[model samples]
Target: MLGYQVPSPDEAMLIAGGKNKGSTPFRVVTGHGAFVLPFFRKARFLTLSMMESEVDERCVTRQGIALNVRAVIAFKVGTDEASIVAAGQRFLSDQDQMSVLTGRIFAGHLRSIIGSMTVEEIVTERQKLATEVLDGSKEEMARIGLGVDALQIQSIDDGDLGYIAAMSAPHTAAIQQAAQISQSQARQAAAEAEQESQRAQAEYARQTAIVQAQYKAEVDQAQASAGQAGPLAAAKAQREVLAMQTELAQRNAELRQQQLVAEVVKPAEADAEKTRVLAKADAERMRIQAEAAASHNRVALDRMLIDQLPLIVREAAAGLNGANVNILNGASGLSEMAASLVGQGLTIFDSIRGNLNGSSAEDAGEPDAPEPERPQLGDGAHPRPD
Candidate 1:
């Protein structure tokens, strides 16, 4: 612990006053520990960490425009033994000079590269200019045991000359015009969208009002219908009651008519029919009695006419005797006279019988039988013995 030496991760240990190898005067130890004898060896450290340097230089371009350029270089001591030895021998006495020397080295290369390019090339192609500068400084940096990781052109401007500003004027004007056009288009679109939203809100309000009005109308109609329901039902019930009463009255009228026919009309019709039958029987009995009586009277009348026939003959002879006294052919003439007188008496008897028969039929309330005609006698006479 007293004399043992170790290098930091970013540093290399350089041990002098010792036997070393390969064209070097000191022993370099990195990333490990080493033992050093007291007073026999002097151990020192060289930084191997990243370092930065900035260069600001004025140079005229190929277009003869004087431009001020600022650039940054990132460098470090190499990790190899040879590069470490070289860096330690030159910078170990004063480590702060590494940044100073690196800045001077990159500044020279920056002036040289800027001299070969125009102002436009330097401004627009900053990366190309940095690359060329880095390439041109590579071998020189390696000789001093330094390596560059990157070179960046920080800025390039013509101080107090206005050359760079003049060169960018046209592009700046075009970009400004394009931005103004885009802003105008966005404002117009916002205005149109706001108008459309207002129209949609108005339409929604109109629809809501219409729907509410329709709902109110429907509710009113329902209320009116509900109010009328009871009266309508009562009227219908009254009509039904009236219809039933009318039907009952008609049924009672029909029942009364049927009762009248059964109680009064039926008995009267039967009595009338019985009376008509009895009257017909009585008339038939009377007709039979009349016929019997008429037959008996006709028999009596015939007997009486037969009895009066001789008397009538005598009277006829007597009347003849008084009237004439002449006789011819004597006995035969007298017999002929007697026979004519008897025939006249028989005819007179028949006439009296027919008259009595017509009178009997008239008294019996029957139609009269026709009378028989009487026979007429001749005007010839003969006298007879009285």
Candidate 2:
């Protein structure tokens, strides 16, 4: 850069090289190996227009104890050094004049960083301030033949303690939550274990109680049985004794029954036998008397026959030999037959009379009147008593 004052856009100046004897729109001055110049448009293009040209640029803060402003802006016109020199030389030949223009163009960026508080922020973040200033300066100066590609804010010295602390808060909360989760899991596990332990204790207590109750019940049962053992044994023994006595009594009664059968029953059976024989003999005697009475009944039939004899004889004479048997012949025939029947009838009457007085005879012991002898029935002697 050359030390010179920037001129207005309408300013015209002479070229440093003596090759041109007249003034141009931009003035140029020669530097050590390059030329500095000013133009209406950037990149040394001196088109008579008021527009700023496009290019790439960068800026850097000066490294001393001053404002944290951009003190330098590196311009990169698209063309190479020869093109840059040619573009500058076409309108401006004085390099000092071109430097003045370039300085004035970039000066506004330095002014933007001039506030005392701007330095306060710049002091906190100089690199960021420089990066912004460089960008603005490059654009401001592009109208004066300078351009740039990109600008970057390098490392900043701003303090991040609060941000760092804020960033750690979530991690701290997460760690606390993890600890809480771990503690909850442990507590839950412990609770489960306690519940299991309680269940085990309850089970053990229940089993122990059951065993004790069973033992107590068994002991009570055994005691009750022991208390009843003597009385039950004695009662059973008494029942057995009673049964033996009853059996002996039954056996004695059976013996007595057999003896009675032999003595009283045997005699009674003999007497019944004698009574049956006597009753049979009496029945036979009564049957004989009834037959005798029936025979006496034939007396009336004989009388009827006697009266019917003539007709009987006539019937007989017609049927048999005309001659008949002799009546009243010999000792007995029909006449004797009839007479014997009458006499037998009378004897039955006398027998009945004797029967009527039968039991009185033994009471009085009187002699019974004898029956008159019936006339002999065609016999010389009456029939003897049957």
Per-candidate Cα lDDT values, in order, are: 0.85, 0.53
- Candidate 2: worst 10 consecutive residues by lDDT? 48-57
- Quick one: best lDDT, which candidate? 1
Which residue pairs in candidate 1 collide? Answer: none
Q: TM-score for each prediction? A: 0.54, 0.27
Per-residue lDDT tens digits for candidate 2, residues 242-332, read 9999999999999999999999999999999999999999999987876566446545554555565555445533443443445445555
For candidate 2, report its TM-score. Answer: 0.27
Q: Give the C-alpha miss distance for residue 254 in model 1, angstroms.
A: 30
Shift of residue 146 alpha carbon in model 1, Å? 1.0
Model 1, 318-353: lDDT tens digits are 687556455565666555566667768877776787
Candidate 2 stretches with Cα past 4 Å from truth are 1-185, 188-192, 195-203, 206-214, 240-267, 270-274, 286-386
